[model samples]
Target chain A: MDGNKILVLDDVSVRYRKQDSRSTSDIVKRILGKSPRNNEFWALKNVSFSLERGDMLGVIGKNGAGKSTMMKAISGTLTPASGTIEKTGKICALLELGTGFDREMTVKENVYLRGAFMGYSKEFIDSKYDEIIDFAEMREFQNSPFRTLSSGMKSRIAFAIASMIEPDIIILDEIFAVGDGDFRKKSQQKMQSIIDNGDTTALMVSHSLQSVRAQCNKVLWLDKGRMVMFGDPNTVCDAYAEYLNTGKLPQTESLAATQENPRNRLKKNTGKRLAEAAVYLMLLLVIIAGCFVWSQYDLLKSYVLAQSLTVEQIENEAANYHRQIDRLLEVDTTRWDTGIFKEGALDIINEEATYTDVAKEVLLQAGDLSRDQYKKALAAAEIEAIKYSHMARLDALVAQMRTEFEAQPEGKYRSLMVYAYTNCDRFYDLEEDCENDMQKVIEEIRTFQRKAGQSEDLADRVWNAYKSEKTYLLSYYCVKLR
Target chain B: MTSDKANHRFLLSELIRRDFIKKYKRTTFGILWSALSPLFLLLTMDVVFGTFFGRNMPHYTIYLFCGLLLFNYFSAATRSAMRVLYDNAQIYSKVPVPKHYFLISQSVAQAIDFAVSLLVFFIFVAIDGINFHWRFLYLLFPMVCLYFINFGIGMFLSTLYIFFRDINYLWPVVTRIIMYASAIFYDPSILPGIMRRLLNCNPLYMCVDYFRQLIIHSTVPSLSTHLIMIVMAAICALLGWFTYHITRDKIALYV
Candidate 1:
């Protein structure tokens, strides 16, 4: 909390849940109020560290030793599950080399973008842009996309951008592992200059103990998410070196054991979470309500329109609508059912005579009629069915003219209208018989329409039903009065 | 929280700029695809359904374009935004930049594409012989609302995606359903009564329908349209933000 302290951490602990082990079924089970097995591990546990102005601290740890996690916690990317981290000023983090640089964008563009990621303003980046390019020695390929650059070149650019930004704290993670020896020496000099500025604090996580001993004044050693040592650079570095060699800590009092227990120190209050849960519940309810209102939006619009209209206006609209319908009804039109059978009857009438004769003999046997009587009845039935088909076609043409005045009706209505009017003129030139086969055709169509309606599969059902009926009607007598 | 005011503004512009560049990267026609792709879709859909519905509906092409523009924007923007967190895990998990900035930038980039497509839409409108009117400017209202809605949904989806990769597979199916329900290529007026009402519930349809009302019918949108849009935008944005705020801290670990 002191003025010189640029960054401070008090008992910061970060827990990471392994999400890969969770399955979709587990999610459903959890939603059903059954808790799944926990798969959480502490990435950083009760980590407390502080850095003052001009302090150069080096963090040393083995793989999976919570080095990156601690840096992330400091940079503000990953919030600690339990603990408080207080920082005095902006943090410029280079956690990964070329972290925010777009591979497709030019190196120059990446500088500005990466600088922005570090929380630097455009004008500020612009002012420092030339210095950064010169420092990274990327002037020749600055216009080229970042991906075209070598790994060392990318790291230099990343390092140059972070070093040029004059933030209160700068976090660098393994940036020195890349680039040539020349670049390393140059970057080391840059770090020295930053420390010499006496106004900025730096935290570097590195595996190079030599660099930590040479450049950093303070050192912190970590092992498995727990801080093992924090002291002068040489002392901790020696201890870390010996530990790495022997896989054993120095015979010194344990820092982790001396620190206060994390559980008792961490807040256990559930009130805030309970309130959040209630708010989430309310949000879900409101969302559902909103959906209901949205679903009724059409109704809402009509109600609004109705409200805006006077009684006389409503009456006038209603009268106008009725008048239109009356005009449509006045024109003599074919029934919706009559037009359907006409099309079916025409197909059968157009078939080859030989095929029909064979079908007629089969139908005669199936019908149990005397052969001579069957032949005569089949001829009469054929003429009557053909005549009815012609009359139905004539009725259709009249209906087309009636529906023409109405606005474009779509879906079933339009199909009905179209079916009625289609090819009606073609039947006009043909000879006609006055006798009607209305009773049989009407019965078949009603059956088809009923099948279509009940199944809610109108088009397919109608077509399938008509196909089966077409086979029986092929012989004319087969469809006779049944 | 690390980003101050100036930094936040610069970061947003940069992020938007990156998204815009990435969208057309390596493509031959590049940004023109924004206009050409939708125009191509419009032509195909017009040919397929134009004779069926076009004969009865005046300026049917314009009506279809209005729906296509809004629906495509909503679909593309939200879908891309769904993966923003996962895609940019390299940056956000390392740096402390605000996570929602990426979502905002993505939605804005898609909004830019919508704007370009809008220009193409107007060209078709003129070719179809419909006169332009001042009321068309009111389209800004729905466009802005739609941007928020897309951003909000993107935020919500991206959050879910970080925790559950299955969302990557599930979202397209949902968007497909939304595409059908939106009635983008077809006229809602022709749909059955109950169906039309349900379609109204789809926010994408509402935005598309408003565009048609203004561009094709030349009728001013009613107060209810504006109210519904604003309400939808607010609810979605707030809900998205709430979910995001709740899970943002955990996102780094998950990603």
Candidate 2:
């Protein structure tokens, strides 16, 4: 928990599952939680270590001893299935020499290009440009293609450029093996200086026991993916060398033994994961809810806008529509004036006027008419026809009464008037309408009053008097016949 | 999380440059194919649909181009984004930069392709004598919205691709369905009422519809339509980011 401990590996174990081994169906089943883990192997088993600031830790192991895997986990390229790897500073994993070199590019270009892969800015590489060339002793060949260089030259330049990266924690994988002997010594001195500075910490993998003992104050030795020793470099490297010579793993304190029980640790890790999942789930809910609220806001806004009018307002609007129709009717009255009923006019017979022509002439005369005016005209015409029919019936009844009076002159004049009035009422009351069965008797009366060469005063006098006493005169005619 | 955002911004330019270089490396066409392919697709779509399948399609070329460019950008961005972890495992394993830098960088590269294809599309508009009205200026709005939406989907799918890997193959079919549902060749109005309504809910379709509403229809989208697009982009971005962060730690393992 102090500032001194720059890196801590608390019983870290990395498991590598055979990713491509399972069939598609098996993978689906496994994903669906219908099956268990398949073809998974733990590469590191409860390995634990810690390094303080300015600490130099050398890792010594045979091939496949989980050394590379531990380095990868430290650099965060591999995720551990269990345990934890925590570092408190900037970590620069110095991978293989010339890891990203473009063979077609010059050595100088490779420096910039490789620097980018190492996550260094162009300006940083620019600042460190000269120093790298001097260290690698490739100043003369800096402009030459990287492919043209000798293998030694390439490795020297790559190592020189990579080592210029000044970070808090440095990860070295067989880095000391770069360059020839003198260059190796110079690079080892640089490594020692980086460690001597209180600001830097290093974890390195090396095959050389002598070099590890010479350069590193502490060493970790591994055998078949198990840590054999972790202590003073001289002691551990001596033990490691002894084991190599004797072909046996020496009995030593297990570095992972002091760690907490893994079940308790699993519980802790699971608790942390559950908390993370809870946070993510809560965030997800908030997002979904926010999305819903946004859409609903839009929906609600449009809904409210579309449904803005109330039922009472709609009823009021219907009333307003009726008022508008009346106003429109008032605006242009002639457009609705065409007569639809012409049956009353069709029954009229005249020597000069055909019924159809009479109807057409009446229609022509009903100019600039409205609906009410047309209806009134049709009713008047119908009344005139009824009056004419009644006039004819009155004449027939009067004639019959006169024939009876000849047989008996004093017979009932009341009977004659009653029959004449009852039968002739249609002609007397000349109210016009559609579909009536008589012609206009007023026209015939007017024609009789307006006979040729008659004086104007006499015509006017007879027209008025005739309307007043026509029924009286008819009853008198019946009495005279008697 | 804030530090991750800063990391991406710090290396943003470099990341984009690296992505562009990586995408077109060693190819004679370089990045020109980004524009060229959409042009070719537009031609093929115009010929096939304008002459035959969609004979009733009004301005079929531009209609198909709108969908093609936007969807193509989405496909390109997501395809590259899907491989961000697996393809650049070397750099990621060496450094501790944020994974989102990869997504943004890839999306920017796709945006360039989108811009190029769009330029070609506008030229066709001029050739066809479609009025390049002031409304066309609003196409920028939808274009910006589409890029972000595409970024969001890329982040979502690429994150899932790390876990499942099968999503890589499934994605093509998924995009094809989206394209069909988007009314890329045929007008969305030609779709059944329910289908059109459902298509309105599609974020890709929403973006396309927004563009068409502005440019093709020469009308601003409704307030709700604009809201849906903005919300869709915002929500997708939110989900994409958190999905990435939540699954980010497991990316190396799963890949």
Give the top-scoring candidate (DockQ): 1
| Model 1 C-alpha lDDT per residue in residues A1-482, reported as the tens digit of each score | 89777788887888887665477788788889788546677877777778888899999989998999899899999888777889987788888876666778999988888788777788888899999999999899999988898888888998898888778898988887778999999998898898899888989999999889988989988888888898899989988988989999765444535343354565432346557767876886787687676645544444444356565653444344443443333331111122322333454555533223422432322222333333333333343345565455445543654455354543343333233234223223221420122223334445555855643334343334334443223223212211
How many clashes (backbone atoms < 3 Å, residues ≥3 apart in a chain or on different chains) does model 1 have? 0
For candidate 1 chain B, the 10 contiguous residues with the lowest summed lDDT are: B188-197
- Estimate, for each residue in B1-255, the C-alpha lDDT of model 2 and write its tens digit: 124333334467666766676677668998788778888888887888877645665666777777887878877777777777666665565555566777888898889877877888888878866887877777777777777888888888888876777888999898888878887777665554456557867888887877766666788876656766777777777678768877776676665
The residue ranges of model 2 lying beyond 4 angstroms of the native Cα positions read A18-21, A28-35, A82-84, A100-110, A113-119, A133-157, A177-199, A223-226, A245-277, A292-482, B1-10, B52-60, B126-137
Report the C-alpha lDDT of model 1 over B79-159, residue by residue, as the tens digit.
898989889887778678888888889888999998999899888889989898888889899899999999889999988
**What TM-score, computed on C-alpha atoms, does each candidate reach?**
0.73, 0.69
lDDT score for residue B75 of model 2: 75
The TM-score obtained for chain B of candidate 2 when compared with the true chain B: 0.91
Q: What are the DockQ scores of the candidates, in order?
A: 0.34, 0.17
Q: How far in Å is the alpha carbon of A27 misplaced in model 2?
A: 3.7
RMSD of each: 16.2, 19.7
